[model samples]
Target: MNPVDKNHWLDGLEASVERHLQHAIYYFQNQDSEVLLKPSVTGGWSIAQCLEHLNRYGHFYLPAIDRALQRHDGQPDAPTFTSTWLGSYFTRMMQPETGKWKIKAMKAYAPPPNLDAHAIVAEFIHQQETLLALLSRARRADLTATRVPISIATFIRLRLGDVFAFLIAHDERHIQQALRNLPVSQDIDVQAVR
Candidate 1:
């Protein structure tokens, strides 16, 4: 288990979100549309599709988080958050760690093919900004007590902190997934001539 600083975990996570925003910006600015929209080498989602998938989650989660925060408007933040066992399990499952495990996306979250790469990238940037704003709001609320409904089941709720952790980890997973899907350059041929 990683040590949690009582006062700084959310702030640290906010910083992490900022880093993700910057990374996405770099990708959008540096990568051409052809690269961004190319189908994965593994014949799965393209980079744009991966990002749209994240955006689709944002559409549900961001509003749900907003409502959760509003409902707990009077609650004070605890000195530290300790995630529920189930919440912790779900969060851990989404983390990219070694990227060895691949979970199939539910049908509802999958992005359609041939989406406009530029538009999808822009939407992702906007959503990340919205997430950061929500995290800032979260620091003043009881994150462990604030519950957001899971996308799969509206009745199944997780703590706000866990939701953020899961979403952030999920985003990282797809970002790396999209990067991996980029077509490999085959121009270099270094055959060993013995």
Candidate 2:
């Protein structure tokens, strides 16, 4: 693991998130043979499908956050979740540490991989903007001192202090999964001219 400074965790999260975004764009933009479609891998979702899965969380959960935040009578009383909350399912899957004794289910809520790709991509940007806006509008202390409402999992809430980092780590996990699905080696003749 690369050594990261504890003091500037938000900065580190932002940097990693950007790098992951760059790679994800490249992965999707260029099919490059196996990347676009490969069923050989066991129980693997195609890159397109993976992108779809990633966006499902954003499309569904971020809006839920907005809705929950809106329900507050006072200033942004961060979110409090129960076992029945839909967002909790996603927060667990996209969670940073795996099986680290988090109060999340091992199960994933898979949406059908049939959404329009362009629309999904467009909405992803909008979702990110919405999240950032919510964070930006929050008081600095809320982002720092605020921890995620569910304590059974020990997950950090997106206070200004932790929001950026959480986004970055969340993006990184999916990015790596997409990369791993790519074929390790495809026989190509370098000697022959293209």
Candidate 3:
């Protein structure tokens, strides 16, 4: 087995996410914003654009979870995977493998003309910190019981033990994409997560 597999899955993922975030913070701190924000390829999101999209979408899981947590009220009970039409769609979305969906969605984002890399990185850090706060407050039981907002048949193969695992993977997936989309940043090297 890979050394990564030996670690509890979400624990390994959380460590990776922290490392990735450190690289991003350092990159933004030192990088020349104009160069990083400049359009790299004709048909792609620029670094600033990619960062904006990640900032917006990485919280996909947390808002709903926060609502549930607020209502959790210390009872042994919490909501199950109840499917509203929108909820079903949410489930379908959160169910994809390590960002197969995120890449597709990222392709669809175009940065507005006025935004700068500085704004994008600032937004990214703010959003990531919010997500980390949510995760820190999440109870372990919540992690296990939170049914993925998905159909069982879809998840049976992965049988993800909890929502936290999925959320951690979600962050890492987008972080990887943003790193790839970034035009070279100041001396920092953010190798793609293997």
Candidate 3 achieves a global lDDT of: 0.51
Q: What is the lDDT of residue 118 in candidate 1?
A: 89
Native-to-model Cα distance after best TM-score fit, residue 118 in candidate 2, in Å: 4.6
Model 1, span 33-96: residue lDDT tens: 8888888777888889989999999999999999999999987767677777887777778877
Question: What ranking emerges by lDDT with the best candidate at the front?
Answer: 1, 3, 2
User: What does candidate 3's lDDT look like per residue over 1-194, in tens digits?
Assistant: 11222125445545655765675686554566775566545555566766776665554445655655565447463222222344334334554342245435543343564567786787777766766665555433233344434222333322122444555555555555456555543332444343
lDDT comparison, 1 vs 2, better candidate: 1
lDDT, candidate 1, equals: 0.80
Please give the lDDT score at residue 153 for candidate 1: 88
lDDT of 1 at 21: 85
Query: Could you say which candidate leads in TM-score?
Result: 1
The segments of candidate 1 whose C-alpha lies over 4 angstroms from its true place after superposition are 1-6, 182-194
RMSD, model 2, all Cα superposed? 9.0
